[model samples]
Target: MAAAAAELLSDEGYRADGRRPDELRKVRARMGVFAQADGSAYLEQGNTKVLAVVYGPHETRGPRSKALPDRALVNCQCSTAAFSSGERRRRPHGDRPASELALHLKQTFEAAILTHLFPRSQIDIYVQILQADGGNYCACVNAATLAVMDAGIAMRDYVCASTAGLAEDTPLADLSSPEEAAGGPRLVLALLPAAGQIALVQLSARLHQERLETALEAAGRACRALHAVLDRVVRERLREVAALLGD
Candidate 1:
């Protein structure tokens, strides 16, 4: 596996996709994709595609016991469609991986959102994977950020995320499916770029302490790059909405 991954980078330092070690896959995003939801967004990073929808800063449903007196309850659900990946999944939700991803999303957004302002209210965020390549968590974070922004919810800062891996002692940014399958140590980071704060960090596989800092720095750089792209998307959508309103 190491030998195969080592071959992934050419002598010219480009990966099989012709991207430099530090290069990220192209990011395309759109806001307000769903009219019925309070807010919605779609994002594509390379071949991975995700859609996110936000609903409510409204009264809690099902159980009033879940409501908080000092802050809004943030609930998140993340699921991949049966055909989202190369191998079809049997179930859509209620699986272990989906449950774990949903929990992570909840924790990530709770940190970025100004929950204190909406005491006794509930906010629901739902994200679905339409396609899967790699870096699903990062893509979900980016999509959720846009959806929340469109909902006009108060947030301290945008949450940007990216994945990094180490191959042959070289740090690689924004890993693709092939790279992820190569079995290298991987790190996922979700950041508040403006405040230089990290909302969440998860590591898969063992990484030596000596190389941890370098890998983390690479992930941070990729996250900041994603933030730039997401900012542009938001601004463009706002401009379009303004024009339509004026008309």
Candidate 2:
């Protein structure tokens, strides 16, 4: 495993994909990607791509039994397409991994959204992974953040997410699939940048106690960087809409 991880970084301090250890992959995003949905966004982080759509802040569907009296219900579903990963998946949803990701997304967004303002209602966030490389959850969170913003829902702050891995005692940010497959300890973080608050943190594999702080710090920095990117995308989208309305 160490050998695989060592190969991830070249002698020149670049990853096999030619990225510096601390650098993130190219991020491309657009808001209001779907007109019919209340809000929608598409995002690509390197080879990973995801689309998120938001609906509601309206009356709860299904049964009132599921409704929360004091705050809005946040329903989230995260799924990967059959061809998203290298190996084709037989089922897209309701599986263990997908269900777990859905729950994580719900918890992350609940921390940032102002649910109390829309009591007895529900907000549905649906995210689909069209392509998978690494950092699928991070990509989903970032995409969902844009979708929520486009919906004009009240949020405490933007939720930005990123993944970090530890290799040879050095912390690496924004890991790609190859880097992730190298069997290193990985840390994922979702942050509310403006408030300097962490919405979610997930650690996979195991790392020495001494390395935990460094990994967390690296993930936080990456999340902040991602927030900057998402902010720019939102501003650009708003400008385009303004121009269209003016015409």
Candidate 3:
């Protein structure tokens, strides 16, 4: 498999889609896109489509067993649609991967949001993957960021995420599934770009010491790029909101 993937690497160091090693898939995002939710956003990166919704700063309604005294509780459920992938999936939650992803997402948002601001409350963030290309984690984070912002939630910084993979000993940023499947180490990073802090880092496969640094650098650059796109979307959303207010 490694040899097969190695063969897929291009002579010019570009992916099959012609993206340079450090380029991200084109991203499109919108905030307050759903009328039903308190906050919602639809985000697209390449062929991956994800929608995130934030439902509350309301009091916890479930079993009191889950309530926290000093801070808001963050409940996150990450589910993919049945037809989200090339093949159909049977269940939305309770599946092992979905359960794990739910926990990870809960952790990621908890770190970014100021939970203390709304004590004894609950914030529910539900993310549904309408399509799966590559970089699903990054897409979820990016979409959720917009949803949180739309909800007028306070946060310390915008958390942007991106993936990096080592191809032909070169670090490639924002890898597509083909590149990811082409084999080598893959690294996913959730970062606070403005603060230059990493909130999460996950590595798969193996990579050398020197290669990891280069990969981290590439991931950082990809995250910064994602940040710019997100910022533009947020600004556009505020403009629309302002116009509606006629001010």
Point out the worst 10-residue segment of candidate 2 by lDDT. 1-10
Tens digit of per-residue lDDT, candidate 3, span 219-238: 99999999999999999999
Per-candidate TM-scores read 0.97, 0.97, 0.95
Whole-model lDDT for model 1 versus the true structure? 0.93
For model 3, the superposed segments whose C-alpha errors exceed 4 Å read: 1-5
In candidate 1 the C-alpha lDDT for residue 212 amounts to 86
In model 2, residue pairs whose N, Cα or C atoms come closer than 3 Å (at least 3 residues apart or on different chains), thus clashing, are none
Cα lDDT for residue 213, model 1?
85
Per-model tally of clashing residue pairs:
0, 0, 0
Q: Which wins on lDDT, candidate 1 or candidate 3? A: 1
- Mark the 10 consecutive residues where model 1 has the least summed lDDT: 1-10
- Residue 62 error for model 1, in Å? 1.8
Candidate 2, 38-138: lDDT as tens digits: 98999999999999999989899998898899999999998889889879677887888899999999999999999999999999999999999999999
The CA lDDT at 6 in model 3 is: 55
Error of 3 at 10 (Å): 1.2
Write down the RMSD of candidate 1 (Cα, Å): 1.0
